[model samples]
Target: MNKIELLELLHQEVVPALGCTEPVAVALSTATAAELVGGAIEKIEIIVNPSIYKNGMAVGIPGFKHVGLNYAAALGALLSNPKDKLQLFNKITDEISKKTIELIEKKLVIVTIDRSKEVLYIEAIIKTTEGTARCIIKNSHDNIFLIEKNGVLLSEQKELTILDNQLYKRLSDLKIEEIVRIIDSCTEEELLFMYDGVLMNTALADFGLSEQNKDGLGIAHSLKKLTKNDVLGDTLFSRIMVKVASASESRMSGCPYSAMSSAGSGNHGLTTIIPVVEFAKYMESEKIKLLRALAIAHTLNVYIKQFSGKLSATCGCGVAAATSASSAMVYLMNGSTNQMGKTIINMIANLTGMICDGGKIGCALKLATASNAAVMSAYLAYSDIVIPSSNGICASTPEDTVKNLGRVSKLGMQTTDKVILDIMLEKVMNNN
Candidate 1:
């Protein structure tokens, strides 16, 4: 892709989402299928590819006291908006919870396997009072294809899967310098457009603070206390940390506010943007400079995630957000391109391979630590400190180190992912 096309691609891949992308995808598929059926769905069947199951196992759905494909399916069928896309399950409300519980009690949801396909597909079948319909999302979450109703096919053609597979190859081929050039030189018009991301993500953080949901980690409260302190030195850090961390805490706990998501996940967007925003505001930086830095942070995350794939055994947020923060910190310090490059290397060496269990309050804790690491790595790079090529997973250059980290995440961590998934499944299956 050319620079303009690549920027647009990154924009589309990293969009808005509510709750965990996995379960929202389930709800989206279910909602689309139910729309085809055209009535109250009597029975809902979900068939997921192995990768989907792995990503969905531990995520939360706001208002639902459970985390799994079944509840997601139920919530989707009960309250989802087909046109809303990323906010697929945003319609879920307290009024619908009672009806959803009744449906669960009736054994109306059946989650099964898609035996005749690859390890990355989801087929949701809705049998309603009128007839049966189906919807399938392939490649990445919310990439819906082939919606069918009764004996009539409502939609056909799966357009992106074949093309999306090529994305991993293309990303692996990109040079880190090229990615940096794209971010560093994007025009003001293009950079300012991402204010949409800031607006939506900030709104969600505010909502999480207001709701004070017990399950949430109270990042907002922490910020409030810090702001209330009579001291000015700590107030800025407190506000930014609280804003960024609280958003993660709320989203992980299934907050209803839509997240300006990246790489099919909202937490990814929050993780990447909040730290940069917090730091920029702390320095009383110019508004335009802050926007440019935010753009750099968000787009760099998308760039890295392109190589990492949408879902991985390793935590994309850890490296993605950290790299973004590194670049933004460099920009804020008026550091040179070399400084930014070194910051990226420092970040990759320090925070690579954090595991993603699922979206929850604990994720906030991880994000906080990652944000701290990002600040440290960027400061170190600005001060001319970077890991050498001889270090473990380090290479002769920054780009080489990143590629090495990608290998570890996509190839080296396969067994670790399986072990984590197996343990999670065991806990869920054995709970009753």
Candidate 2:
């Protein structure tokens, strides 16, 4: 791919998103459907793919103390501005929250799994006193493909077809060395977007650091305690873990802040970007190198996800995205393409199988573990230590190992996703 076209791909893939994106996607679709009807919506019927339902079922929505798709859909209908995209929850207010809660208590919303589609699908139907509206968002989390009112078409966009055919094809085709060169060749004008990512995600890290979390489990809190007790003695590795995990903690808790996301996930953004930034700062690397490294890190993430489907039963943040962070850290340490490749294989060989049960506060713990593995693999590769392809499922080449990992997540993990969802559904039902 031409370097110029790669820039456009970067702009498209990296974006700011609020809350857990699955729920935010839900909010966007319901709000769009409700707005078209233009009145008090009496009922909402929402059908979502397994991944959406699996993710949205447990994560809390911003500005609300509850968890589930019912509340997210109701609030999306009540307070959403279709203009907000994935960040729609940022504008939620007290009155709207109260009204949405009332709607929930009255049992006016229904959510069900859509067996018709495989991934990233949401179909919302809203009925008001005057008429009914329907909206369909599919494939990409932010894609709004179809909208209608009273069987009259409101709009049409080919999100599903275009995303899979054109956009993803270009992204998936990019080579790792080509991606590194593209970042290294860019001017300062081109890096402003990445710097914006540094500013946005770091603030969330600071906020996460300040949280007085109970159970001693929040990433910042836990890391701080470990440092104080002298168990984790390396300040550099500890700092990297704290910064990356803190950001995940903030985002996973619905901190009401939007993260500059990579490949449709805020946690993926934090996992991929913040650790590389921290390593640069600690080493006093030049601004240009710092910028280039971040660009490479994030692009590496998007590149990997092209093989590993965007949504998967496995934790993308830990396995794929953080693996990118490890490779970027290797580059910052002056490791060559061979060393970077080794780092990629080393990390994926270890962390490839972490299951993504759901998004919640506990996800920060997994992010911290991934960050540790990222730093460890980088250091190991710097010393010429790597997991050879002969070990287990690792392929001879780094990119091939990544492909193997993707195949395992996308194709080899069906029974895993089903078992996880079954357990989660059982718990939710038992609680209710």
Candidate 3:
């Protein structure tokens, strides 16, 4: 791909998001529909694909104590702003929270799962005193395909499918060398926006490591305390792990801060960006080099997601984003593109089987693990050690190996995904 195309891809994929993308997408859909049929919202109904239901079932929503799709939809309908998109909750207040709770208590919002829909799908229907409207977001979060008001179609974009198909095709065709070359060709000024990710996620890590905000799993907080006690040495690996995990903890616990999401996931952003940033700090790398490395990391993340599909049973943080982070780490070390490819091979070999149950506070542990693996894999590749092609799922080329990993996530693990969703659904039903 050319430089402009690569930058466009980064702009599309590496945008900021509040809360988990799944629930945020639901909110976006509801908000859009509610705005279309302007009036006092009487009810809201959201039907989502299995992946959305699973991920949005329990994750925290930003600035709200309640968590789940119902609450997200209620907040979205009440906000009634499609333009706010994922950051719809950025300006939420106590009155809004209380109104959201009132709507939920009245049982005005309903969420259901549709296993037959696309992995990233949300259809929101809102009923107001004036009329009813519907909105459908498919494939990517915030990509609205259909918007209707009072049973009449207000907007429908047929060209989006063609554009999305072409985008994925171009992404899947790229090789690691070409991606690195694209990064190298860019001026540091053009890539300076990449540092925003470091700043945004570092804020989250700082919040997680703080003593007071102990809302999440506490993985990062505990790890930091261990370092203070000298129980866990203040090594580069531990620091990177703690940083990434702390960010995840803060995000998963519903901190109001936004994360620069990579490949449609906030946790993926933490895995892909924080490790490379922390490593750059440790090596005292140049700012330009750090931005270049981030460019590589985010671009490779989108490339992997093109093959893996947007959501799957496998943890995208481990297999996709961390793989990119490892390759970027290699780039930061002045390692060859060939070494970057080897780093990817090492990452896939190690993290290929990590399952994604769903997004929750526990995801902090997975991000921490992925961060550690990224460092280890990068160092191994720098030392000229890599998993052989003959090994399981390892291919003669990194490109092919990535394709293999995607196949495992998209095709080989269908049953695993269903079972995990089934378990989560059963628990929700039992609680109800």
Total clashes for model 3: 0
lDDT of each: 0.74, 0.83, 0.89
Q: What is the lDDT of candidate 3?
A: 0.89
Model 2 spans > 4 angstroms off: 159-163, 211-219
lDDT of 1 at 114: 54
Candidate maximizing lDDT: 3
lDDT of 3 by residue, 118-191 (tens): 56889999998999999999878888989999999988877454226776578778888988998899998899
> Over 4 Å off in model 3, which ranges?
159-164, 229-231
TM-score of each model, paired residue for residue: 0.88, 0.95, 0.97
lDDT of 1 by residue, 1-432 (tens): 446765666666668887788888888898888776678779998998655776677777866777778888888877746887767665677877777788788999988755344435788988888889889888778778778888688777756553355554555466656665666677767767677887888887777677555557565566566666664236544565667777887887776777887767777788777777777767787877887777667666766665555667777778876687667878887777677778888888888768866555677767767777777788898998989988888887766777787788878877787787677778878986
Instruction: Please give the lDDT score for candidate 2.
Output: 0.83
> In model 1, what lDDT does residue 305 have?
66
Query: Which one wins by lDDT: 1 or 2?
Result: 2
Q: CA shift at 214, candidate 3, in angstroms? A: 2.8
Displacement of residue 170 (Cα, Å) in model 2 is 2.7
